[model samples]
Target: MQIFSFKKFLKEQFILLSLSAIVGILSALFIAFFLKLLEAATAYRNSHFQLLFLLPIAGWVIYLSYQYLGKNSSKGNNLIIKEAKGNQESVPAVMLPLVLFGTVITHLFGGSAGREGTAVQIGGTVAAKISEWCKLNQQLRSILLICGIGAGFSAVFGTPLTGFVFSLEVLVIGKMEYKAAPYSLIASLIANYFCLQLGIHHTKYFITSSIPMNGEWISIALKVGIASIGFGLAGYLFSYFIELFKKIYSKILPKAWMIPIFGGIIIIILGQWLVGKDYLGLGVDPNYPGAASIVGAFHAGGSFTWSWFWKLLFTTITLSAGFKGGEVTPLFFIGAALGNTLATLFNIPIDLLAGVGFIAVFAAATNTPLACTMMGIELFGAANLPFFAIGCFVAYYCSGHSGIYTSQNIGIAKNSFLQIRNNKLLSQHLSQKELFYHKKWTLVKNKYL
Candidate 1:
């Protein structure tokens, strides 16, 4: 019986490893194509400034495509998270193309968004389809889904370690899914390797300043800690405003499709007249030199003092208005730009703080401190891992219970005093909290009036 059990376990492990490789290859290929298309779209939009006017039409077309052909695919990354968490719903294959098409259109017409969400969705869709084809059991299916996420993220960003950790950390707040770690790591490594082999290069960020040692460590830590609070608040506000704008748009627009049209108009006004074009598209590279970008945030005076706020506003409006794409890159922009601004006030090196903020804000918003910390090391080297940890962990806690993904659950409460029930969705928790406050307010009004 022992021998037979060992044989079975070995067979399963072999099969899973093979599947991970397959998923990695497929994810890398899809992401490469997606990136190419996205790059072309952004370049064209930069040259033809008039393309911004057709944003409404582009949004309308995206709405029609999803409404007609996508079915429940509009749930986007949430659907993948739900499925990974044991929901009966399956991630549809059509999601890959729909999101890819929508994201490309969004960038082509100047919608301020990022690409990570789209990549993750594509990876999840691919994994789901492969699982269906293989007729895998629920347990195996869940593991593959996670591997897919890791593969997609790793391929897109060229950070295998971050992708592996992010896959486990992102599914649940305050909990890491260790069961999937080995498979996720394998998928991430394979995907990153294939992506680089295919000639896709990720952006590079460096910390040029000297690392402080001895007596300066204390002051550096203090300053990083202070800036982390701001990073956390920024992340909280970003999540809060996205949810708020969604509600406001839904209330104001009678038709479901009209929301994006209105959002497009607002973006046009904000991008063209008010905020300028710095905050549009992926923001990895702007149209002109010295413009605000993830790359520019490394140097002193690379970004305006208000650059972070403007990017935050543009992204919140773009995403809330129903544009396609992910939020991670925009979060990087916000974090880095904000870090650049704060560096002066705190008397820290510009590159160091900017690098820390790049990951810290993303950590806060996603509630994945470990992954973001790893990302900092991957992007900027391990010389400043302590600062990275300080900023990421601080921002994670300071951001409160809010996060970019509504489907994420609270596996454990952040604090013992909160008394939050475990395994509840963040959206449900937010709704219940609102109800509790409303009841309190109503009671107060009745007694007073």
Candidate 2:
């Protein structure tokens, strides 16, 4: 019986790993297909097709979809976050095709939406289908779903570690799934390998200069404080816009589908008018490879063109209207733009600052500062390791009381507040490491008491 049971366990583990690998390969193929589709659709939609005729038809389809699928259709990555928190809300298997179709439709009709989120969901939903077949328990289900999410993100970003951390950390906001870490890492690495083997190259960037840190602890202090505050505020603003858009939609629209269709129309109108049609989708040419730095607001020099605000406004409106896509890549572009906007003030090079903001703001907005900083190191290289670390910490704290994942519980102190003591790492019960008004004594004081 013991020998048979051991063999059975081995068989199960082997099956699970094989399934994971297979899912990873499928995810990679999908990522490639979707990227090509994105390029073709954008070219056709912008250059070949007329916006006036295209948007109305897209709106009609969305209206029908919402009517049939209903407003309760999962809200993409945000929905995944909730599921990570033990909601046991099984994502519909159709999520893969639905998101793929919607994202294609969103971009094809000239809406300014990104594709990473949809891509990740597609991979995740594909991976998650195993749970239904195997009848997984909740804990196992969460792990499987996370592995799927990692595969999708890894396939898309081509940054395997970033994808793994993103999957493990994104679960409950502040909380990390220690157990999911191993599986997520394995799946991401496997997926990244498969994707790379198929010639899915990573998005690359060029760097010009170093951040020029003096290696002093105090120097890092100010930099961290300033940058983190900016990132945190940016995150707060992002959430604010989402709220504002929802309010507007609730007031004016009949249902959810009309929101994005109209948003697509608005983007098309604005693209034609103020900024031209270049700045649309996950990112424009500005966020592409060799376009590392951004333009100054004041300087009219034509070295680089970065439409910081327009992209933000466009993506915000696009997502608010229920257009499906990844928010991270757009957030990356926005952070880079914000960093570039402050080039003159800090006297830092545009490239350095842009790199810092690229990761920091996204980290703050999503409450995944550590993961974001790690992404900076992984994608941007670790030349400014200290800077990314400082920036991520600062942005994370400064982000105030907002998070992209609504289901995330507030575990750490939101702001300055009294803990059982000033103890960040608390014991089971309150120890002598308590804080009163403004004082720090020790065991002696507690003993005296």
lDDT of each: 0.91, 0.67
Q: Candidate 2: lDDT of 356? A: 78
Error of 1 at 162 (Å): 0.4
Give per-model CA RMSD. 1.5, 8.7
In candidate 2, which residue pairs clash? 117-326, 228-394, 228-395, 421-434
Deviation in Å, model 2, residue 269 alpha carbon: 3.3
lDDT of 2: 0.67
Once model 1 is optimally superposed onto the true structure by TM-score, how far is the C-alpha of residue 177 displaced, in angstroms? 1.0
lDDT of 1 by residue, 1-449 (tens): 44568888998999899998899999999999998899899999989878999998998899999999998999988888887776879787889999999999999999999999999998899888998999989988999999989998998898999999999999999999888889989989998998898889888888987766877888988899999999999999999999989999988889999988999999999889988988889999866666789889898778999999999999999898888999999999999999999999999999999999999999999999999999998988898999999999999999999899989999988888898999999989988887999999999999997
Q: Residue-wise lDDT of candidate 2 within 79-144, one digit each (tens)? A: 665565566676777677667777777777766666778767877777667767877677767777
The number of clashing residue pairs in model 2 is 4
True-vs-predicted CA distance for residue 77, candidate 2, Å: 1.6
User: After best superposition, candidate 1 residue 290: deviation in angstroms?
Assistant: 2.9
What TM-score would candidate 1 get against the native? 0.97
